[model samples]
Target: MSGMVTSAHAPRRDETERADGSPVTIGALVPLSRPGWAEAGRHLLAGLELAVGEVNDAGGIGGRPLELVVRDTAADPQRAAAAVDELAGLGVAALAGEYHSVVARAAAARADALGLPFLCSSAVIDALTERPTHRVARIAPAQSHGWRTYADFLLGAGHRRIAVAAQPSVYWASGTRILRDHLAARGASIAELDMTEQPATAVCDALAEQGATALLLLVGHPEPAVSIVRSVRQDPRLADVVIGAPAGQPEFAEWAGALGASGAGIPFLRYLPERLGPLGARVGTALRERLGQPPSFVAFEGYDTVAVLAAVLRDHGTDRARVAASWPHVAVEGTRGKIRFSRTPGTGVWQWAWPPVQVVDRDPAEPARFRILHTG
Candidate 1:
């Protein structure tokens, strides 16, 4: 009887618990407005919310469920910094969100100073990961890679004499410069058109006068693209010239028609939200179902950003140190492509960027298709 009591009295097992004996809560800062960011924010929120739900369902972190606290940055760096500061105050294990490069820079510094592992979800500017600051990990590829692909497409097609139209933002300026430099290296003549001062008509006319046969548009806004196309079509000499864009935003289709069908026949690169794998699709569907729409490339970053952070959280168990140390492996298959940060110091910004170059050519009986001109 004593032997039987000893066998039955074996110490009961104890469940694992966190240092504070609490569940992990993550924080996210995203721009819900500022054109092209709202839909993306919703998609990312859905992706994150769904993932968190699943994580909790599987038995929350350290036997405690997960929670997320969210904030909006509005695409302004100052506002983003404030948002980051606010999220930081929540004592979250990790922080995520903020896609604009400038905003990322500020938020990254804040996260680093606070020793928070910052997962930059969708900002594609090369400035985020290029710093020695090393406080941030990105799940988005650099825009330079995309620009390189654009240059290669132009060069391989034997298209010389290129005209570029760009907005004044650093994102556009930097990307344009990268593409321009690459094109020049490959023996392609370039004409830079500053959209700040000159209208699209003036810029197109100038390019036409300069004997430009192909126009490579770098402007993020679709307005300039449509305007340029209208001008080119009006000038019979420039009408048949090859026109290419990095990615035509879907939200601009009506604007494309408003500007005229000339650009409707041209080709542009498009951000494909559906190609980002299961995690991306789930988030995208959630956003559409909940918000009545899907997100753009920027917002897609939000879903990817949250996914990467959640993976880190699952592995590290609420340790900021472990999360930062393991960031190079936080692979996020976003709408663009599989993304993660490079541990190598002083590398260019963006951990992964998979943007496809596409042409928006009009069909006689069908709608415009964003055909893949080349995959970067």
Candidate 2:
């Protein structure tokens, strides 16, 4: 567990000259073995690899190649903590790349205990960075940011009455709460339904009966979200209801497309659409060449995390403390837009103040032709 799991692309590091001449190693804790998230983890790793390759191609940080030490968390909190410990034991300078909020929480604690710099890539739970830590930062926008934006989009679309079918996970629950609060403040009527207990058909019927104009599917996992979408689409009475989800954007398009005509026009929030900026276009091109698909939001986060970390390493050396201290002042151009960190009251730690996001609808006829309805 104290040894590095080297990839073929990673440069070899001399053990004797590790202090000054070895490759700078960063630990990546991702859910590589998780059932539903395996493919997502691969995409994240691909992004990390692309960034590392780019950095190395550009002469790396101070002439030392950047290398990744990856571990599979399986989306399990205990496994994530253990992975952090393992990476720390292997002497990684910093830690990054986690998709699940629960795993990020445990990994953050372990990273703090080890005094290692941790830059969360995509975990969006508000409490992940709520407390000040000497070495924790996040590149992803907070849940409130996404939820508030979603609420604004709903209100702007003239959706006065909205129904929310949400899973009970912290990711979904927190998002639901934020949406509810924001919509309530804007005088929009809200109906909340638990997706775990209630049948999707019953929920769809209830929303239709209540004259709901939109259905916000807050299910965190992709499979369940697809199931709900299928169920909702089965009812002809609910055909006019605008369906939306905060998680699983472009990836869910394929699952939605599996429903044939039923999934044609469902909308979802995407954190970093490929059409955002020049950097996004570059990332998209690289991803398509490498993975044969456009980059996912998680992939964008992975690339940005490594890109920012490389910049920090270039300026601050590989010292974890220095890198952590410099994070608050670090700003780099990300795939979606400019990446910057700021201390927020909600998450009383340095985190990406605002990351670009967009609302995109699925196009069953052409999954690649997903339409962007709103940008933020």
Candidate 3:
């Protein structure tokens, strides 16, 4: 239950050491065993590894090589909190890497309690960064920001009557509420269906009966979204309905493949594209070579997470307090776009106010090839 791995002896640091004969260790907390998100964690680890290799190859931070101490959370909140304490016990200068929003919340609290600088890579819940502590910051935009992007896309497409299918989790519910409120302000009507209580076919039938022209999936996970898409496609009356999900983009291929030809033309919002900028292209190529596939936005976020940490450690050394204090003034151009953290009224403290995002759909013949529909 502790999820601790005990070695016979202390791990060797020679291979990871720099010219200064020391290693600046960073702790990476990711879910490697969650049923639906294990592959996502692996992809994110690939990105972190890629950035670590590049940083060490370039002489590291102030001649001290950066090392990553990875811990798997199993996508569980309690385990994630324990991982934070475990990493701090191992003497890591900072912490990063988390996929699950609920787990990220636990990790953030633990990191703050321990006075460690925690840079959240991919968790999008608004409350994670809203804590009273200055030890936490996030790279991903909050769910409200992402939902607004989707709302704009749906409204701009002339889809006034939209239907939403959402899971019962707090994360999904909050995101769905944002989407609903935003769309409602623009004179759009929306019907709701609870994914946990109803079957996908029944939900699709209800939406079709409501004269819905578009379906927005607020389910936080991919499997349910995929199932709903497949079920909706079975009815000829809903064939023209535009299906979109902001959270399903990371695991697009897995669920989209289940839908096969039916998944094409379905749009989802992604934070980073394959060829966003120079850094994006460079990381994308490295990921394609390492993972044997294109990099997801989560991967890009992972890479940039390390990049930002390295920059801070280089200038501020490994002092946790200094690193956390320096985040407010830290601003740099990253793979996706400009990377900066700011405190906004509704969003949590030290959250990335805006990150570049795009709506893309899979090419029917080639699922790997995604065509961009809109950008914000």
What lDDT tens digits, residue by residue, belong to model 3 across residues 233-282? 88889878888777745344566556777777778878864456777888
lDDT of each: 0.62, 0.77, 0.78
Per-candidate TM equals: 0.78, 0.90, 0.91
Predicted candidate 2 versus true structure: per-residue lDDT over 1-376, tens digit per residue:
1112473333332241255646788889888884537767878878788898888888877877778888888889888898887777766778889888878888998888888889999888888843677588898888888778778888889999999887777777888789889989889978888777776677777887899999887765555666777887778888788887766543532454455566667776778654567778878788768777666777888899999999998888776678889987787988877778888767755788888777777676775567777877
Q: Sort every candidate by TM-score, greatest first.
A: 3, 2, 1
Residue 81 lDDT, candidate 1, scale 0-100? 75
Highest TM-score against the true fold, candidate: 3
Tell me the tens digit of each residue's lDDT in model 1 across 240-348. Answer: 5777766444333454446544545455444453245766676667656655543445545555666666667777766667777876666755545666566533333
Order of quality (lDDT): 3, 2, 1
Clashes of each: 13, 0, 0
Q: How close to the true structure is residue 25 of candidate 3, measured as C-alpha lDDT? A: 81
The reply for model 2, stretches above 4 Å from the true place, is 1-20, 250-257, 273-276
Alpha-carbon shift of residue 72 in model 3 (angstroms): 1.5
